[model samples]
Target chain A: MKDIIIRGATIRRELFFFLLSFIIAFGMNLYAIITFKTLWAELLTQLPFLILVTLVIYLIILLARIVFLGINKLLRIKKNKSSV
Target chain B: MNSPYKSRRAFIKKTIIGSTVLMSYPWLEALANESAISMSAANKVRVGIIGTGSRGQGLLYNLLAIETSHNIEIAAICDNYEPNYQKAIELTHGKAKAFYDYRELLDIKDIDAIVIATPLHQHAHIAIDAMNADKQVFCEKSMARTLADTKRMANTHYETGKILQIGHQRLFDKKYLDAIDYVRSGKIGNVTQIRAYWHRNNDWRRPVPEGKPELERKINWRLYKEYSCGLMTELASHQIQVANWVKDAQAVSVIGVGGINYWKDGREVYDNVALIYSYADGTQFIYDSMTSNRFYGLEEQILGDKGTFELEQNKMYSENPPQPAGILQLVNNIEKNIFEKIPIGGATWIPETALEYKGEYITGDFDVNETGISLEVFVDSVRRGKPTPGLFEQGYHASVWTLLGQQAMETQQKIYLPEELKI
Candidate 1:
């Protein structure tokens, strides 16, 4: 049951990051369309570009998450040594 | 044996030339005439300009631009105002004979045609005199200040048998011509309504040269009732002409309301106006002009049953727009080896409102100088010794209807076009 809870939480965290990345990609595309005075309907035609941008953002987030976890682990080790 | 490459090349060249000729306006047909191309002193059309104000100078610039290509000459120029007269003489590099009075300029028998760019009230008089003097007249738009003068001008054109081309430049614009063609070809499926507006945020006033209070009326004649019909004739006339041309019918009646809601600087004309002109076929041309807000700068929104044309923007929106090929759609087609609709956006993703479809351009090449084209065509007509068919009637009706709209606003009643006014 504990393993199941951890797996579910992991999935939720991944889903959150993916959704954030997608929203950012959508916003950037929307801004570009508006700036160019193009139709809002262009968003549908730019599906591939949107998906590519979202994946690129997600990869960057994932890399940042790993770096943040590593930094947190190092900080915790330093705190324990100081407490000792 | 016949060379296939040569035949193919010949065929392509012929097709291009044929399509260009087909797309061109009827008056522009003169450009292809052999007589028009042969440039000589005898064939050159000598043009006299009666007004050297802003509009007159604009026409002069266009004429100068096309002088060499069209075999035209600025024979003489006349203006009562000192500044404009001096400026016009400088524009022609002292080539055109300058005159203080228009009659003296008209007296020059060698001047084949005269362009009238004077104030609204002066159009009929100058045009009539020029035509009577045996010179073809190319007068600026909104034919005249009064309906009687407008009618008289048309009558003079008819009686003299001289070319009287009005400055409705849209008739010569390729975008307008293409859009109108679409309307006529049932591409738009019967235009139901047309909404046109011209808006600006300026006070519509010109400077009076500091202490020269007397020159206000002379310089800014458009603001006064005696010299102009204000926005109706100055701005609305062009759009009304477009609406009439699109419907191929004049406004049978008009009901309007106007007031000096803003810019209350003792100007006789209204600062804002809203008018609805009804056609015989139940079509309505909704028109308005204002000098207070300019959010919607200007456009002729021609709405039909199947489509809509925003002429100023050069776009046409269809009721049933074609779906463009997206990446997912292309991938789906390749995977399935067949084309089929795929529901990409699910129920939650679907938009609540109607889809905002971006319409296609009316034509790719739309950066045309319509004023130049109109003047070139007018010069051609003068050379041909004939007026362009239907051009005079279009200008006449636009002016008459514009005056009728003014009357409606003044009386606060639906004004119908009188039988006698329907030339």
Candidate 2:
């Protein structure tokens, strides 16, 4: 039950990151379209590009999360050693 | 997305697509064709500049900018004012023959066309004289100071059969053309009302040469009644022309009010004006101009049942904008979590304010130099030995209606366009 709960929390976190990445990517695409003064319908055709940008953002966010966790773990270990 | 459609590639694709779309327009296509035509030295159109004032110098700059591209030459320049004549001569690099009298400039047989940028009162006589001299004429807007003079200018054009193109540069503006096309396509439905205004905060005065107060009236001709109709002819004429173009009809009647409310600088013309022009189809064009507030600098808001076009900003807002479709809609649904449903039962609720729809641009490129393009088109017409169709009529109607609006203000009554003024 503990393992299941952990897995569920991990999935929710990943979903949140992905959603954030998608929003940023979509906003960037919309900005580009409006700036170019082209038809807004072109956003539909730019789906593949939008997805690529979203995935890149998601990867970056995941990498950042890993680095942050490593730093937090190191600090916690240093505290444990000092306490000992 | 990874291999071929990266950001750089996307930019390139958009640029290509945008240019292709622009090229499909008739004016751009014509401009391309015009640029392709090369002329020999002997075939160049020899042109003259009349009234080398501020406006004349502006036209001269545009003319010189396109001299090589359009196969045109500034053969001569004429200005009675000593300072303007000297400045014009300097601008031409002393290549153009300088003349004190415009009649001497007109006498030159080599000059094929002349651009008249004189004061409002001088437009009709100079343009009429240029036409009689067998020279193609390009005169500035507010064709003349009075309705009779405006009619006379049009009559002279009809009588001479010479190419006469007025300086209504918006007729050649790409953004305006595209917006008009959209309006005609019924994208905005029928334009029922147009609210246009030009507001500025300045004295509208030109500095006299130190200790030369006598030159004040001559230098600042726009502020005097004899020389100009002030804000109406100088500023409102341009917006009125746009309103007329959007409606495709001239103002049938106008009622106006004006006063020299703010400046109190002893200028004969009004410093502020507000007018309502009624079109034949009952379309109302409300126009106002002032020199006291600079907030809403200038705009012609063409409103219709379906949408509104803020022309100066080159933006269009729709009453009923389309919902996001395909990928956008999918993303929006996922973000909003489509599975969630909220119950709503309330008293009557309605939006009682303007919709916050961010409008879209009317055209891809908005950096068009309309004045330069207008001059280039005039040169092209001169080369072809024919006038641009509908240009003269547009200028004529705009000038006539604008003066009538001024008349309405002075008479304190609704003024109608006289039948004789209709060409």
Candidate 3:
């Protein structure tokens, strides 16, 4: 079994961390590949769609955050303008 | 031609029974009836309802459809909205007494139970007061808007010992519960993350007959932050609560932003939002909502190392490893056993059977919200004096909703939790 690693670097502080991460990452990747038949499986490694979605969603979510901030600022300015 | 037990019993019981038996041969078969199905315990409860808005009338329709003997009665109905109240009146078939104020209906002696479906701001105040009145209460979701109110609700319910069921109905859905089981059973192999979203178009409007902008906002409390926690509480509460259920832990931190964009109309809350809610175990829940796009709709996709399940209300699709992976197929070249049991007798000739692959299957139930499984459970808990899932403490979860939006609006920075916001 592969040990848990972050960015291909094995965890040194705790051996169990390596084991846990390896199992989880492997299993999730395997499941993701099997379900969606995604590109992650072509490289002999499994991928997790859950993680993919999570990452993608969060990325869009950040964009949404910026968009909201812009709108909030605009509204504040518009309110001040009308009052003046 | 019928036997004496059937023929003589009918004669002895009643001459009308005899007429029925004689008529059952052909023409009068329609007169026969089946016995009602019932699930009753010793203790029974009669219920009253306050605030017959859209949510309340939904509860009313579900209550009327129950043919079981869980000893529940829609003894009273109350609503400030006249049309909604009228609809509830028709739905209950005038079986319950109608009222405008909840206290007046609570005064009725026979109404031993109350279900509050009022706006978010009034949940704690009404529910606590009802509990103090010694009535079992089933309050709708997002119990209150403030931490202090949530604490008071938790206190009152704990003290009164009244059967209180908060209306986070997803807790009662079969798909959600099974999804929890699938993840917890390690089928997904330590589910590290989840994504939940709901998308809609058309600025949440239901024609105001004659009202000021303030009145319209008051009527449609969901569009305003003063009465609602916006989409986080109104819509995302159901999904966010499930994140805890599936991940088996409370969210540790949350960071997000929102703004009113589409159909501004001077609403206080935002039209779109995206949040990354972190859990104590380092897993994260990504939740979002948008008003400009209804194409994506609602979905909750959970991924684990072992498997993945994508859910849309009653429809659920789960993906496990394929059968071919476990099979040798036409060519007997492959033999990979994920979990192979040792031969019992240690004899090859004795024939150890190869692991059978049943393949994968999808499971789904149609018309989930229409099925009323959650409402029936609420009523059963009330009547049997039993506890239900998602108690008033779950309302404290709404505190996170308030905390998330308010902090984001005020600080203009991502929000982090100093304490575990759990009841």
Candidate 4:
């Protein structure tokens, strides 16, 4: 087996993808919180709660990435088998 | 060993003080473990109710009936109308907080779910808002006033991935389930047609107070086009839902004829309607509703080549006559004098009597009410964080076709449901 390493360009592309994902996840949750009229003065004062929300969203995005990559690999294998 | 009820009660008491206290109560812990009672006080699903009219109140009663079994509490109730709001509050024993506006009720954080029993037009807005609030929704049937609103509600359900249960109680009805099974199992032999009708003689109106003539339309919303589609949404929706369920498909097209033949006193909606919806498989559902006559009140007949079943009557009639019972056979033989030596028994000696076919009972004693069972299912789904499958689509199809039928009636032409609206 050959040693594998990710290139700088590949790492940059991955970072861009993660940044976009984070924006989408956080924006959606924030929009939901505002829509439900849950952004009270008391709740807004709590920094830990906001941080926890952000962390949960990050975890969700990470899980989604794993699931999507797994599905992509499965699809590629299926395509190869069909070609064979 | 203590009874399940006793154990559950004791567990509730111990868990209420604290989990530490519950751990110390070894008997309660053992009872809870033995009974598999996993729910604690925090796990109880809090429900907010919108619209406390007759239908909404009935649903509240059903919810209350199943509260103990399902671990649900009516946290809040909302109705703009003062009388209804007060009545609903009283019904809840003043346990639930009452709100004049639904939005105020929706603002509460502890409410895990919302039951929307508002008029037809308000369903989409409230349901979409509830889902946006990250609350599971159980909206009453005739999902929305327009095809566009119906589509939006359905799409929102998909986008949110929250449990959206529409108020189609027939879906949870054991009798209807058994009937569907019988129809699908070839007992009815390919249901070719369904005839459904709801008839009443009285004016479909709630009496308004003498001082408040301006509130006439508001009080009797069913008679107005702005708030409701009259009998189509109020009555025919139930039968149409059953038809769609039995066929296992929605109508492709519809044609209808309706008019204000009776009760035309400032009413916007037609008093009589006759519509036919054609399914993809060529099965037709013939529907009619009238306020002029109350005779033959309401029923749905599922007709096939071999047999026909009247769902409301709970009776099944077969095309081929059934064999007579042993006593009846003996009686027939005695009447015909077949056992005795027949003096001049001819080939066509004259039929003794015309064969009569009285149908047999198909439904048994169902102790559980349909609405109660449906509420139980809805609460269970909300608690489990998953909707009862296929319920949303059933409601959507029924509502779409109902509106399509209304459109056909209004346009005076055949109406085909647009492809986009099919889902």
Candidate 5:
């Protein structure tokens, strides 16, 4: 199972993955909106906070990815230095 | 595979990360424990609030907000603090008489229930007295500042026929309630351990009073251990209660380390503390409170085998990807979307072209509220005499959170629940 692993995935495929997730999420959101009357009201009322949360979550994911990549690079450099 | 120093650094980072993830579990943890079963009823149960301070005010606010908080009315208000007493009177539109002594407040004619939101030391005495006085009571968290007091309080609660609810309100929050369902439903798998934390900046900001020596300390009693349990009662108890709610079990034993590193203003309670509680099921609930930082506001986490739910900053959410993105998925999305509109309808009807992917973030507010939901339910239970999600045991459970921490601090050794202690 460990040998069966694959870490590298390309950008388009990532987009495809994102789209798939978003679809599932949106569908669930729609379902929630239908079932819960308050969701509709909240979307209308607390729209600003809603937008802010979305922006923040987006930034977080981006920042997290950058930091993760940076850390990975730092580890690689440290490894090379130790080898030398 | 790794260098010695590198491994050491990695180990330290991993340890920190692991602890962090553990601490993150209870934020959306134990959905307010749902035991909304019926209790035998009595009509016209009048309720009074002692220590009409912040908590008293907050409860009043909740009571007013709740749609159907039944026949019970605030018969009286008591507070050593004149401002709080006056405020409650104003909130009640002066409908309720203000009393300086809680004894007077508790003795209000025909009063059947009392809300004791006074300082920690007063909790055991006031609650036991009120119960003995034949009134149902809701005392604030960290039931008592002392183990002796807790033993007495618990005993009194059991001995008395009157209902006693402790002011551990998270048992009422909807997010916690929903999360508990997930936990019980085994969504996050079998919950073995839970963690909680409360981090805040500023020096407990209890105002340094001018000239009024005795009264201010008596009223703003949380700053001193003689009258209060310090942060153990004031802050840690809140998170500890949350851990209890998450575990759905009373703490069996606890060990903790506490240090008053931040606030140096003649306070006895540890300014920073960490406590670990064990349950009968071999589960552990851990808590930490540090006043020097608000890097993390407030949250608790319940951990299970499959995944962990992160309830933090009042939003109960979960994140786990044992495999962040499977190989096929990673290729299908990562490769194709960046390359072309290449409909990868190979072998499987993968809707690659159909949906556009979001890389930055596709986000929405998960309406997982923590505080308000429970407050509403508590009020509804009182008003309609309907089954309440958070009832008497929640109070006891919360008290146990405080007591466990207190004992750990006192003995410098782990404290265990009494043999009789049970949910």
Candidate 6:
């Protein structure tokens, strides 16, 4: 029995990822805005910088995930049986 | 092995560079220095008072005293009610011109700012007009009656780039500032829950002149749904504002129950309201406002895993258990079956103080009154020509949350902050 090799770039998956990222990013931005009481206009002015930072963080997080996954595979540590 | 090491090194370098770049951003520098810009007083800031009711008169008194320290003058006064207008004029010692219409006062060319202490419903319109007239505004809290009105007032403030200070005095209180600092510094740990309540025994009504059933509602506008939200908007706002400040987050949803169980004297608003407002992080602000009981006068308790902050008392209690007194320990042990056969007889058991005193006053002796500090800040901000950052948002959140809580009570369901006003 072979596992199906599914591409990660499917439209549905892409959309889901985009929504998830947006929701997380926007939620954080909203919190900062509420907490600091920064005007929306001021926030929008910093959007470019904020977007860059978000992308950098996302990339770093993705790299860390890949690193952890690789390390897990090397250890041959079975995932908890209950999860499957 | 080399590739992984290189990857790790690259990650660390990127993080350092990213942080440096973020720190060097000019906008952040601007934010830091935003309120530091000061102005030399060319002359006095000519101020106008609108709505000369009890709240209006009280603010007028503060403003009058503030004039001695700050460069401000009461240039004009306005009120719909004749008696109030006359009373405000008397306070000014006939220095300020009286007007029946607020628009007439706004038309005064020399007026630099307007202090609006009108009923909750009238706040938006007066503030908007004043801002349009290039006048700085200090409007009383529960900023406006409706969501749209509150949004409009804030939008107008942003558009005009005018100094718009909502009358939430706690923002300027040294004690509150220090207490909030303590919370933010994680001294009390993450605030998981906040409980606030304001209780009073009176019916919250102002006596009207006889032979005026129509004027009863007008005089006691706080009891009417169209004008005010009774205890929620009137009293709960201050505590709710404090709760938001402690959590550093706005409530995402609110579930409430309220009733006109007592003092039903033809009033439209509820006499009692209990609301649980949940923030995005699942922290809840449990708030209650009642008119029939004065037992628990007022309090805002910020509860965390490490400790609890009682804002009313300005005290903190540690979560760590205290060492039990020897006699109390003996009594407890006997009760728990530790000494089942031992005879334990007592005259009446006196309750011991549960927690030891770890909470200390965050404020110093020279701390100014909250309202006075608020006025000083407002006057200073007006002089500087820069509106204080976060002031509008504080008022906006408190107002929006109060209205949301009211909606929850009226509908008997949980109500969320509207998506449009989420930020």
lDDT of 3 by residue, B167-267 (tens): 77665444564555556556667677799899998788666767454558658888777788777677887777777667655676777877777877877
Score each candidate by Cα lDDT: 0.86, 0.84, 0.63, 0.78, 0.63, 0.76
Model 6 misplacement above 4 A: A1-84, B1-41, B321-359, B364-367
- Compose the digit string of candidate 3's lDDT tens values, residues A1-84: 989547533345334544444555455445544565555433242234334434544455557768999999999999999999
Candidate 3, position A69, lDDT: 90
TM-score of each: 0.78, 0.76, 0.64, 0.72, 0.63, 0.70
Worst 10 residues of 3 chain B by lDDT: B25-34
User: Per-candidate interface C-alpha RMSD?
Assistant: 6.9, 8.0, 9.5, 33.0, 12.8, 22.6
Location of the lowest summed lDDT over 10 successive residues in candidate 6 chain B: B22-31
The first chain of model 2 has a TM-score of 0.84
Of the two candidates 2 and 6, the one with more favorable DockQ, higher being better, is 2
The first chain of model 1 has a TM-score of 0.86
Name the candidate that leads on TM-score. 1
Candidate 2 or 3, higher DockQ? 2
> Per-residue lDDT for B1-423 in model 5, tens only?
222322332332333243332223332121222233233344444678887777778877654443122334666888867778789889989887788888887666688667777778888899899888877676667677776777778788677655565666555343454565556667778788788888888776555467877665665577777877677777777777667767766777889988788688777767888888888899988788888999887778777786566554333333344222222233345457888765555665555562232211111332423234444334334444332333566666676668667767777997777665553
Which model is ahead, 2 or 3, in terms of lDDT?
A: 2
Q: Mind giving the per-residue lDDT tens digits that candidate 6 earns over B99-150? A: 9999999998878889998888999999999999999999899799988888
CAPRI-style class, candidate 3: incorrect
DockQ of each: 0.06, 0.06, 0.01, 0.00, 0.02, 0.01
- Residue A28 of model 3, lDDT score: 49
Alpha-carbon shift of residue B225 in model 5 (angstroms):
1.2
**Which has the better TM-score: candidate 1, or candidate 5?**
1
- Give lDDT tens digits, candidate 1, residues B1-423: 233322332332333245553234445444334252458788889999999999999999988887877788999999999999999999999999999999999999999999999999999999999999999999999899999999899889999999999999987666787787788788888898999999999999989898889999999999999999899999999999999989888888999999999898989999999999999999999999999999999999999999999999999999888754343343344557655556777675746795578898987766667787678768878988999777888899999999999999999999998988877
Q: What are the runs in model 4 whose C-alpha is more than 4 Å off?
A: A1-84, B1-37, B325-356
- Residue B6, candidate 1: alpha-carbon lDDT: 27
